[model samples]
Target: MNKSKIVVIGGGTGIPVLLDALRKENIDLTAVVTVADDGGSSGKIRNAVNIAPPGDLRNVLIAMSDMPQFYADILQYRFDETDGPLAGHPLGNLLIAAVSEKQGSISTAIRTLGRFFHISGNIYPSSDQALTLHAVFEDGTEVAGESSIGKHEGLISHVYLTDTDTGGAPIASQNVVNCIMDADMVVMGPGSLYTSILPNVVIPDINKALLETKAKVVYVCNIMTQRGETENFTDADHVRVLHEHLGKKVIDHVLVNIEQVPQDYMDNNAFDEYLVQVKHDFAGLKEQEVKVISNNFLRLVKGGAFHDGEAVAREIMGLSKRQAD
Candidate 1:
């Protein structure tokens, strides 16, 4: 069977897990990652080097890399010297920083590294520029950075790019458009509602392509709600926010988790949990004309909630087959 071309739009931790699972199947995958991250090692590099953030890109790359001997750990390696100028930084991010300087473009740097790592899939930033996200709180306070908005304690009124019409990696935009034009399926989310997922769709040209694409648009709803990001978001709330960003008619399918989590887990991570224990409203999705596919998406662990990569891969593969039929 010929591989189905798939374009997955998202960023950060969730994207890599999804990409890792999807790459294991016989499919062509393109990950369009967000560049608005101004936190952790990615933020440091972006602040110092004035280039696209590499943390998200690096995570996606490692996720899509061939396993057993790949640079997954190396890419995620953080300096712990605790006393040096270069301490507390991730090596992969720094490598990207170095490459961006030498190559003079993030796209060039990542492309060069992609070949080096023997990555089977493509990873791209939603934009090539180092951009900040701007949002106003419902309480009338304005927030400028993604990290700051995340830490704020109010609902967001609306969100947009800081430099309207400025800072996009044209190559990434073109890549996303091409992927959409050629894809059998284009999937978004299952990541952070505001930060990881919406950043890609908010881009003008990218959203236009999404609207115009002939591909089936599927939105994977987050398994948890994020504090400050989607404080009161339900499965319906997540889809609504997406439609608010991409228009109502743009999304075709919504993938949601049906497995119920323990209340203890919910209470413990209440401040940090993105997906609460609230029962998802199926009627809400039906009202939006969005088809919902429910499955067991939760993975219980020692310290965090995670999507079962293998299970997610199986689900996506099944969805692809259904689309083919």
Candidate 2:
């Protein structure tokens, strides 16, 4: 019997948490990470070297590595401003950028590092080239760059890649499309909706592969609404936006947190980017024809609310089993 093949799509802190848990499972795992980031040390490196942002990819790689924790820590270590040329950059990001330059592509570099780190699963960038996320606001104003989108006060009408002059439709690598098409289950999100997850799916080939694939599509909704991105958004609103972009109800299951967050547990100073808990909309989710898997998926740690990765992984494994049966 073959192990179940699961493909997870997203970037940022959330996906890495989930990946860390899933790596222990007896399954074939593939991670499709977004490369549209242009912030912090990643932004600086991208501007300086014209490479895809390595921040998220670096985290994902570390999560999947079976190497010693000390090595992972070394890779994640950051240099302060006092470090001169290396200041503000994490060691992992710099290594990935260096390998990408040497290998001549981000995808090749990721594979090379995956072997070096003995990563448990595959990691592929959604695109090989650098991508800029461009959003059009409700007032018809436009904002360019993934880092800049959240700062706008107005509601976002929609977002697209600015890589092309024709339609701004970004392209995904064949490996990315093939992973989605071949997986037994494809998991989306647990990350920023617009910037993290959407950037990967908005690519025409990827969206089409998702619609065409027979794999069970599961969306892991965020535990909290993002301040500048998804303030006051309900569970259904998250699914709705995904469907609106895909042009159909492609989501088969939505894993949502049913547990209530403790009122004072959240420290705004620590989690300044998070706004409030995402409201539940069971009826609305049903209206969209998505099977809702609501559970106590909350994990509160260090004054921040997050998904319990093990619990979520169990549910995902169950879904994969049912799909196989």
Best by TM-score: 2
RMSD of each: 2.4, 1.4
Worst 10 residues of 2 by lDDT: 162-171
lDDT of 2 by residue, 262-307 (tens): 9988989999999899999999999999999989999999999999
Clash count in backbone of candidate 1: 6
Per-model TM-score, in order, reads 0.93, 0.97
Q: Residue 217 of candidate 2: its Cα lDDT?
A: 94
Model 1, position 265, has a per-residue lDDT of 67
Please estimate how well model 1 matches the true structure, expressed as its whole-model Cα lDDT.
0.79
Checking candidate 1 for backbone clashes, the offending pairs are 128-169, 224-274, 224-275, 225-274, 225-275, 226-274
Q: Which stretches of candidate 2 lie over 4 Å from their true place?
A: 164-168
Per residue, candidate 1 scores C-alpha lDDT tens digits across 41-70 of 788788788898898888887788784544
Candidate-wise lDDT, in order: 0.79, 0.91
TM-score (C-alpha, index-matched) for candidate 2: 0.97
